[model samples]
Target: MPGPVMPDQAIGTSMRNKDRISAFLTLLPSIILIGIFVYGFIGNTFWISLSDWGGAAALAENPVKSYVGFANYLDLFTGFLGGGFRQDLVNAVFYSVMLLAGAIGIGLILAMLLDNKPRGESFFRTVFLYPMSLSFIVTGTIWRWMLAPQGGVNILPTYVGLPPLRFPWLSSTDAILLFNWQNLLPIALYLVSLVLIIWGLWRLKNNPAKALVLLIPGVVVGGSVWLWGDLLPQALFMEEIHGFNTATFGIIMATIWQYSGYTMALYLAGFTGISQDLRDAAMLDGASTAKYYRYIALPMVKPITISAIIILSHISLKMFDLIFAMTGPDNGQTGHPALNMYLTTFRANDFARGAAIAIILFIIAATFIIPYMISSYRQRRSR
Candidate 1:
């Protein structure tokens, strides 16, 4: 027993449908362009990575591409010729860790100092942030000169009546914390277990039961790995060692100098957004300035810290131009995946392997970004 629809209701419904159709039409072109360009290219690259499209005929007009499944990936990780790539991967990990620690730590300190409204704050902020305005190439070049073996930094010691140090900043052959590639499987398992245990400990206060679920499995796996690690199959047939090269210290220092300012700005803005009444309340409760920031202000700006970590992680992964300008591609001590990819593709004409490296980098980048995206989406939906 439905009532007859009103003429006004019908008109409004028709108008709403029309509006929906108009919006869809307006967005259709962008959707099409992105599909054919960004996603399409990514799909094509992935296909190339799985194909045998390399060698001398790779660049030919009618070049052949045959499916080879995951062979390229397998070869990169375990092949005899992939030692350089493995070392480069290790270098990238070290670079990411150092950059995250140095930039976030220094930036937070600077932000806290400025939050006190010190004299000449504006000038100091400008001075600290000036390096960020320069391109990576410029920063790399400047740092290269500063870190020279017998010049810039080395000469500073002579002015104070000390002998000029002759340490090779970019050409050093020394490496530390060496680990055999043959132990890769056990090492990887240990890392996973460590992560789980740390994560569980971090969440123990809020959700003890769930934390126990994580901790139990983590401890069991770690103990098992420690006891039976030798039983695990070796990642390679022969031993190959990799470690952190001392040569990359200069590059790391330069990167920290450039990006710390950017992070400082992010943290400063987050600090500025905190309500003054909250500060007064904290003071009334007898909270010292250090305790107020540590216990209250930092927790409020957790999102800012996450954002900085994500941004810096991405930059660290794609550290091509800076590394090239500072140490060049030939400097194996300071190599990165992006530079290695470029050299493999254009210089060595290995298209398939290059695509494989690209896809690996893309996957690594996604690991940092996808989690943040999912968290942000959840936050938005909850709101």
Candidate 2:
């Protein structure tokens, strides 16, 4: 610099600025895209939720007059024009919670088993994962045929030389209140029910009720034994129903089947990505399989496990296709989350309320996802 302040030295700084400008230019399109699509939609949705537009026609006809302040919001929370609302918001919360629990629980169990590497492990993995590939609509169709009250699952027990058993998991009043027992809140009723069941078991120790409780399991074993040996089906006239409360359980089962595979796949990849040396070191340190997985492998895979939770939680909230397909949404105006949302939106032509419901769903999904994403970002920054 003292010698000459040459052209080459100035050229370097000029080129750096040009490179920076070029990079900005390259990214400008994507920046504009994000601003319009993401930010615009969120803003517009919030605005729409405050209005009373009669679908889109009113939006075009009198855009200014379409403004209805928070009348839609008031109706949404209280009653639509004081019509006394019952929009199934409670049901949506119920199913969403059930779906969250079922998906995560089933997925974790399958992932742990898959990591164990039993015989036909790959085959079992495929069986579990394949369901996720199909759309819930397709899953609904398949399970419908199988769970059909008269035609499908109802015939299986009779064929196996047992009593006919039919459980209507899809379209019945078999609602299970997660918190509600005997229509009483679980928080209020659990101890009572637990005490009663325990008392019943104690009383049943010397009665036929002992055998009755084992009925379904016994039938399953007897069916297998008879099938293998061609023996007489000793368990006849089983005219008993098992797994009662079909509608509630049916939706739970469907949600579990759809999301379990996704969770397992996440675990699968997480396990695969761990370094071989770390595993070997744990083994050398006198670790049993269980200890090794719990201490060494599980800690390493915690991030993936958290990711699985967020994904499953989000999917569970918007659980429309599965519920709709499994149980027709119009089944007597019962409390089904998906059907409730759909009917509410269509009946009132209240896109605003629909958007409000959507925001609630978004918040639920964010409850799981946002925290995990933030933690992951902070971890990256520290490194």
Cα lDDT computed for each candidate against the true fold: 0.95, 0.64
Tens digits of per-residue lDDT for model 1 on 318-381? 7899999999889999999999999999998889899999999999999999999999999999
Clashing pairs in 2: 163-238, 169-246, 179-186
Every model's TM-score? 0.96, 0.70
Worst 10 residues of 1 by lDDT: 148-157
lDDT of 1: 0.95
Model 2 residue 118 lDDT score: 83
Which digits, one per residue and each the tens of the lDDT, describe model 2 over residues 1-383?
A: 46877799889989999999999999999999999998888778777767665554543545543567776655544442322222244455555566667776677677778776789999999999998999989987887777788877778888879987766656676533333111222222334444555655555657757645654444444454445433332221222111224365666667677777887888777877788788789889899878877878788888776777677666766667766776676653234444555765777565666666556566666778888889989999999
Best by TM-score: 1
Please give the RMSD of candidate 1 to the true structure: 1.6
